[model samples]
Target chain A: MRNMAKGSFKVQVLQAREGAIVASVNRLLAEKGYDAMTVDEVAADVGIAKASLYKHFTSKEELAAAAMIRLLDHALAFLATLEAQPKATALERLKAVARWTLQVQLAGEMPALPAQNSTLRAALAANKTYLDRLMLVSDKLGEWITAGQKASQLNRKLPPELILYTLFARACDPVLSLLKAGGKYSDEQIVDLLLTTCFDGLCGHAKLRLA
Target chain B: MRNMAKGSFKVQVLQAREGAIVASVNRLLAEKGYDAMTVDEVAADVGIAKASLYKHFTSKEELAAAAMIRLLDHALAFLATLEAQPKATALERLKAVARWTLQVQLAGEMPALPAQNSTLRAALAANKTYLDRLMLVSDKLGEWITAGQKASQLNRKLPPELILYTLFARACDPVLSLLKAGGKYSDEQIVDLLLTTCFDGLCGHAKLRLA
Candidate 1:
């Protein structure tokens, strides 16, 4: 029983250390992006030795993948909370997810990955945990999207994948950072404005309503 | 007179070579983004010595700035042509610009820049030619945005900068590449679909129109 207890305590400590490493990697990725962020910087940020950092994550790509997996897990948990809110419409839930992504971006927590990096893409594709969480999140969002379409909330003319991609695109939308940099609006206002454009578009809302 | 004619021919050849270099840089930027694209790669793509390429553009950032300047020039020229039409509505013109950007992105001509690169930002800022062309393009688009808002063709509640950023965001919108990668939609279909989402949004157009 004492050996089992000691083993459990070791697992917890290792898990905590891994979590701290991921959190540091997430911040560095957000600040300098993947290319500019070095493993040494991540190690320094985590206050750990380079060898110890490598013990947790084999490569920078793995570090990024871990950060993404953590983000996806957070998103999955958020979806669960939204799922519990039975009163929210499918479209409302979709908007809430988008709002959460934008808020994370505004708070400098969203790691903006380079879309064109094939090596990173290969790593992400090979990482089973990342792929699983991504698919899980995609599946949940897909359900909401289909429901929204069925309820005539989302555009039925557009394909479900297009809508899904649009929502995912909101996570790295440059408009959030640009507006945030402009410093004229609060974080809530930035999310609301982008949410409007994402849903309502640039057209006159009154004109569309009147039409 | 003969010497002067030879000088003119030499200048034209130099200009053409510079154009080819910029074109190669543009394609590389689009394919790999800024961080992944190397000056050596740019030189090799242009079939020139790295030292020779440096003679035309001092640094990689200058190469990127030149590509952006060329793109802005193309946009400005397109805006001029649209201006001459005189019959296009402000909203229609804005949509045309957005469509053009989307089309360029689909064609893999759009140079995707890193939004968070401070050094690149400083280089671009210090580049008078790039900054001037950027301002010119922004001012032209800003006019259309203001006109659209004034004519009640765009959402008045949203700031003009928000609308401007939205249009800019469409150029690098991941939806274009994602949909393209899916191989389910034709390029024209992709552009039309994104344009619809950009202007009308993700909401049911029928509901908005019927309302």
Candidate 2:
């Protein structure tokens, strides 16, 4: 029993260290994106030896995959809360997810999802947890999108996949960073503006002056 | 007079080689993005020796910047054409530029502009021709945005800079590629759909079923 307790304690410490490493990877990705992030730097950021870092992640690809998995996990958790909100409209839920993405991006916690990095793409494709959670998030969003389309809340003409990809792209939308760099708006204001633009677009209604 | 002709011929050859190098860099950046692209690969693709390639572009950053300058030049050229169309509305001109961006991107001629590559950013910042032309492009677009707002064509509530960035962002928009990847849409269809989304947005209008 004592040996088992000691073993449990060791496992806890290992898991805790791994969590810290993933956090550093996430932050580095958020700051400089995958191309600029270095494994040695991640190790240094986490106050671990390079060998120890390798013991956990093994490769930069794996490190990125882990961070992405964490992000997807957060997304899935957020989706779950929205799923429970029985009173919310489908479009309202979609907006909530978009809002969450902007908030995460503003807080510097969102990883810049690599659009064309082949290695990172391969790593993510092979990551079961990442793919599973991504699918879950997509599936959840897909449901809302279909519902919104049926209700005429979202344009039914667009493929639901386009809507999903557009919302996902919002997580790394350069407009957020540009607005942040301008120092003209608070984070709340920035999120609201992007949310409006994402759903309504750049058109003028002449009446409300917003689409 | 004979010597001057020979020197001019030599200069033409040098210019031709530089153009080939920049084209290769542009294609590679489009295919692999800035992070996956390398100086060696560019040299190889250009059918030149690494040493010879260095004679044209000193570094990868410089090469990327040159490609960006080429892209900006194309954009300026396109804008000039739009400016000459005196009968077009400000909104029509904006849509033309947006369509041109989508077409250029689909043709694989557009360089993936690095959003956070610090080295590339520094090189672009230091390039006077690039900065000047970028400013020109921005100024032209800014004028259209102002005119459109005044005409009640574009949303007056949104800032003009946001409109400009949103349109610029369309050049690198992942939605176009995603839709293409789904293999259901033609190039013309892709450009038109993206252009409509850029101008009208994703909101379903009870009237047109698009914002």
Candidate 3:
């Protein structure tokens, strides 16, 4: 009984430490961006030695992958919640994802990695757990896109994947930050404008000749 | 007479060397990104010593600035050519810019630098020459946007700057390369899809509600 209790305590401590490390790395990455944030800084923030940090993740690339995996998990969870709400339409779901992603950025929870690293790209590509959640979310969004197009709620000419990339680009788009930094619009106003631009035709009500 | 000719020849040789250094740096920067590319490698690629390379641009930052300045100059010239065309509408002008930009990228003439620099935000901001040209092009684009909105050609509900950024993002958007690299679409098809997404409502022919 004593040994079991001791093992349980050890497991809890390990889990707590791992959680702290993930949170610390995320904060550092968001603040300093991927290129500037070092593993030692992450370890220091987590109150662990660099060696302990290494024991958890082999390199900075892996740590970034883990952080992204967490983000994907959160996104999946958000999608599940939205799915459970039967009142939501397909366009509503996509808008919800965009709004949540913008909110995350505003809340300082967004990752700042530039997505330009070859090694990091390889790691993310090979990360099955992350890829699975990404695909699940992607597939859900893809269906919504197709449904919207069929219903004439979305554009039919554009491919679903192109639409997906445009939506994904919203998360890391520099314009959001630029607008925020300029203090030109309140957060609510910015989100509203962006949402309008994303779904509704930016052309308002104009009719153009079809070639 | 011989001395004057020799002096002019020397000037031409120096100009050629400077252009070569810039090209070498641009190539290496695109291949390895900003942080990974070394000045020595650039020098080696140009068949010159590191000291000789520094004679053209004092530092890596300066070399990069020169490259970016040249790119901006190219953009300005392209806009000039478009403006000179008598029958160009605002949409036609915008499309002309996009087409030229893609052609430049396809030709391997565009410098893929600003995305990787942490200091670029401040560096470019402090750079008077860059700022002047940037603002000039920005103003030119802004006028077109307002004209577009006024002509009932663009969606007035959306901000002009946002539209401008969206267009700029197209030049460097990774999606074009990704789709092309996937072997799924020809370069022409990819560019056409992107241009369509940019101008026409991605939502197809459906009437859009902005409110």
Candidate 4:
């Protein structure tokens, strides 16, 4: 029993260390981006030896994938909270998800991965954990999107894939950072303005107001 | 007279070579981004020795800045064409510019720069030619945005800076590439769909149509 208890404690410590490493990778990736971030910097940020980090994750690509997986996990948790809100419409839930993404990006927690990095793309594709979480999130969001469309909340003329990609694209939208840098608006205001432009569009709302 | 002719011919050749170098840099920056792109690759792509390339532009950042300047020049030229029309509304002209930016990006002519790179940002800031063209384009676009607002063609509630950044953001929007990658839509269809979303928005148009 004592040996089992000691083994459990060791596992918990290892998990905690791995979590710390992933968190550091997430922050560094968010700050410098994947191309500028290095494994040495990540190790330094985590206050661990490079060899120790290597033991936890084999490569920078793996570190990135781990960060992405963690992000997806957080996203799934957020989705669960939205799912529990029984009064929210399908479109409302999707907007909430988008709002959450923008808020996270504003808070400097979203890892800014390049959409066109071949090596990193390959690594993400090969990562089972990352792929699974991504698919799971997509599936959940997909359900809400179709529901939104059926309820005539989202545009039925647009394909579901387009809507899905647009939502995913919001996580790294440069407009958030640009507006944030402008310093004229609060974080809530930034998200609200972007959310307004995003769903209602720049001209659409104006036209509607006129009509 | 003979010496003058020879000098003119030499100048034309040098101009052509510099243009070729900037073109290669633009393509490399689009394909590999700024961080992954290297001087060696740019020189190799341009079919010049690294030393010869450096003789024209002193640094990689200069090459990027030159490409950006060229792009701005092209934009200014396009805006001039729109101005010549004189029949298009400010909103229509703005939409045309957004479409052109998306088309350039889809054609892989857009140079993708890191928004947070201090060294490159410093170099660009120091570049008088780049800054001048950027301001020229912004001034032209700013006119249209305000006109659109005054004419009630754009959302008055949103700031002009938000509209300006939103249009600029469309150049690097991931949704354009994602839809392109899906291979289900033609370039025109992709541009049209995105333009629809940009102006009319997802929720607003569907609601308008339903109403």
Model 1 Cα lDDT, one tens digit per residue, B1-211:
5547457777889989999999999999998999999998998988999999989988889999999999999999999998998999999999999989998898889998998888999999999999899899899999999999999888888889999999988889999999999999888888888887888889938332223
Query: Model 4, A27: alpha-carbon shift in Å?
Result: 0.8
Model 1: how far is A95 from its true place, Å? 1.0
TM-score of chain B of 4: 0.93
Runs with alpha carbons beyond 4 Å of true place in candidate 1: A1-7, A204-211, B1-7, B206-211
Chain B of model 3: TM-score?
Answer: 0.85
| Residue A136 in model 2: lDDT | 88
Q: What is the interface RMSD of each candidate, in Å?
A: 3.1, 2.7, 4.9, 3.1
Instruction: Compose the digit string of candidate 4's lDDT tens values, residues B10-123.
Output: 788998999999999999988888888999998899998999998999998999999999899999999999999988999999999999999999899999998878899999
Candidate 2 lDDT at A166 equals 90
What DockQ class does candidate 2 belong to?
medium
Task: Please report how far candidate 1 places residue B184 from its true position, in Å.
Answer: 0.8
lDDT of each: 0.90, 0.86, 0.75, 0.90
**TM-score (all chains, Cα) for each model:** 0.94, 0.94, 0.89, 0.95
Interface RMSD of 4: 3.1
lDDT of 2 at B16: 92
Poorest lDDT segment (10 consecutive residues) of candidate 2 chain A: A202-211
